[model samples]
Target: MADPILVFDLDDTLYLERNFALSGYQVVGAWMQARYGVTDFAQRCTKRFETGAYTGIFNHVLRDLGLMDSPDLITRLVELYRNHPPNITLEPDALRFLSLPRYKGKRGLITDGPPRTQANKIAALGIKDQLDFVVRTGEWGAGFSKPHPRAFGYLEQAFQAHPEQMVYVADNAAKDFVTPNARGWGTVQIVRPLGIYKTPPADRAHAPAATITSLDDLTRCLTQF
Candidate 1:
């Protein structure tokens, strides 16, 4: 039987996913400047993305910059941004957390997003080999996205582990905890200052079993298992 599972969330949970976004912006910015001679295009694009105004962001950026006449700009930028390979490093806390001698072999991961995009990140972070089971919910279809339970259910089945025997660590309170918490799994949120989601979610079901400011806090709790 598989040892008890320790699942993780990718993106901002394990590494600063903003780093990935920033990398894309750098590429997009340079591509724009070279092709259109736009000054400060990259910085403006980065600011827009960081503000969470992503819908039609490329078109909006162009329009704001008086490049409104550009044809197919949004589609081209979207494709470029999504395809750009990200240069990222695991946070030192993540390295320290994973370096724990006890938790090494039990690790697994569950993440949501475009399969190829997310796959690039996992490969970039070099965490694939460390995982015993992996599930990218987008590969499973829209119905399986987090808080849907099916993705969590998939992990349980993959490892032949039950909810009580699994521990899930993710940073997003908006969607990460609902299914695991409802199923009786151990859920912990790493609310690091660097994490993207900082405010407490309004829904009570989204609350985790425990909350920690860092990954190192998990060592003491996991030893209980």
Candidate 2:
């Protein structure tokens, strides 16, 4: 028997996404304007993330925020993200799954990010050393983004596994699960919203290979898989 691939989404999947208060680029724009008298920060954020380029992101944000666009902007922006910190909370089930002695296959992270920022968050979560691989859409240098099969395909190539053999877990149904399912990967939806609230009316939610309301539900469900 061969090992199946386990491609996990870090933000909304393994960790509770809503906990971090991650809004779109528009929110980042508002934050920058309020902090540094910079208007139109959102357009820069949107372009940087959409194109998978970190250099432009930091430099643009810093310049618009009234900081000099020197080489130090990268360092400054990094410090800001690290020290400011987002709302990061991991599910108990995620900890259990990652801490298990063996997952019976090549396990990896298929997350979307500009790289350094995501790496910082991953390290803060203390899961950096436990995984077999970490695939960042921008870090790969191919200019790709998640929910895109190309990003997922990179892990498939590295693990030498088929999409159907993999189990993908995430919170966004339309962006995370639907695309993977179309590509034949098993999908699990994590529904733990902030304050443990269940949004989007549970009854009408789209069906996944498995549905879990809490981290504790992972063990039992994975056992069946």
Candidate 3:
């Protein structure tokens, strides 16, 4: 069989997304401190994030500091967070996995998020040249994100690959595998220690073809494809 075209999800699959979050929080925090004189804002944001406050985190921090959680304020903070230059690096295991001899020249990346935010991450990781191509779903609109088939379809056309000759490695089960699985692309889930999604998919359709706790097991999992 021909070597499969290996595509990867960018966030937790290639690097710890928490690091990007923390980095963004720092940028937001610093901005808050400079604009509103709120010292330790970044630290407080990190604390809330660590405590599982995934949504409206900035609002919570503002309320905790006795500031008004105004819509305008929250929007600004969010914009700042998403647009800031990110500080991140590839996971050691992911780096090694990409450097493998067999997989060289066959790599691609597909990620979902705001285009600017995802592009910033791609640039910070310095991974553009490492892969054959990248698909930022946001560029196609929110409706085209994972579970939507459009991005995966783009990959299929770009590689001129049959579904059996492609594999998508990602972290999120809820949306990552559904379209790929239905399209007959081999799908593997890489569950990093700090990966956000922990629960298994409730149904087979959303589940990955295989799951690995680390990228080191990626090749072994690929053999099944």
Candidate 4:
């Protein structure tokens, strides 16, 4: 077999997405302090997270608070979260997976989000040195976002791999696996406990070739092909 070309999703697969969310919350808290002189925002965030209310933190804590209902304030909050230097660390399983001998494949990353936001994540995880190619869908515009197949096609070309030789490992089932499945490329979804997306809901119409809980399981999963 030749070296497989694998493209991974950034946010929840390479590292815990919640960690980035936490860091962004801190940034939002600081912005709130500076602009509105409000305190305890972080504490409130902690409470929300503890209760498993992870998504929409900004919408509830900031926008609903009436202190930041303006569009400019929302943009500034987004800028702050996206630009803030994060304390993210690569998932041990992810690091180990990258080093494993069985995955002797061309590795790349394809993420869909604001370019700077995703780039900050790449730097924070310290995996820029690990990836052979990267294509952020938002950089090209929303038309190329995941499930659109353009970014996946871009990765296949960048790695010089045919669709059959290309594999995509990602977390989100709603869109992550759609394009790869439709394009006849292999698709894997790694869902860890810390991932933002819980159960893939088994919708076979979008099922992965293998649904793993650890990146380390990838070697075994790839063999089935």
TM-scores for all candidates? Answer: 0.90, 0.63, 0.96, 0.90
* Model 2 Cα shift for residue 205 (angstroms): 13
Model 3, runs deviating above 4 Å: none
lDDT of 2 by residue, 148-193 (tens): 6787777777777777777777666556666666677777877765
Error of 4 at 71 (Å): 2.2
Total backbone collisions, model 3: 0
Model 1 per-residue lDDT tens digits across residues 1-225 = 334578999877789877888888888888888988987877987889778765566777788887873567777887788877788989878878777676644778889888888888888888887788888888877777887888788778887776888989999988998888889888888876656677686687888878777787777766655
Candidate 4 global CA lDDT score: 0.81
User: Which candidate has the highest TM-score of all?
Assistant: 3
Which residue pairs show collisions in model 2? 20-87, 93-215
Number of the candidate with higher lDDT, 1 or 3:
3
Model 4 CA deviation exceeding 4 Å by range: 49-56, 63-68, 199-202
Residue 54 of model 3: what lDDT? Answer: 76
Q: On a 0 to 1 TM-score scale, where does candidate 1 land against the true structure? A: 0.90
Q: What is the lDDT of residue 165 in candidate 1?
A: 87
Q: Write the per-residue lDDT of candidate 3 for residues 104-194, one digit (tens) a residue.
A: 4387889999999999999999889889989999998758887888888998999888888899999999889989999999999998888
Cα error, residue 107 of model 3, in Å, equals 1.6
Residue-level lDDT of model 4, residues 26-143, one tens digit each, is 8788778887887867667766876788666666677556655567776777788788888798899999987777556788998888898888888877888778998888998768
Alpha carbon lDDT of each predicted model: 0.80, 0.65, 0.90, 0.81
In terms of lDDT, model 1 sits at 0.80
Return the top candidate by lDDT.
Answer: 3
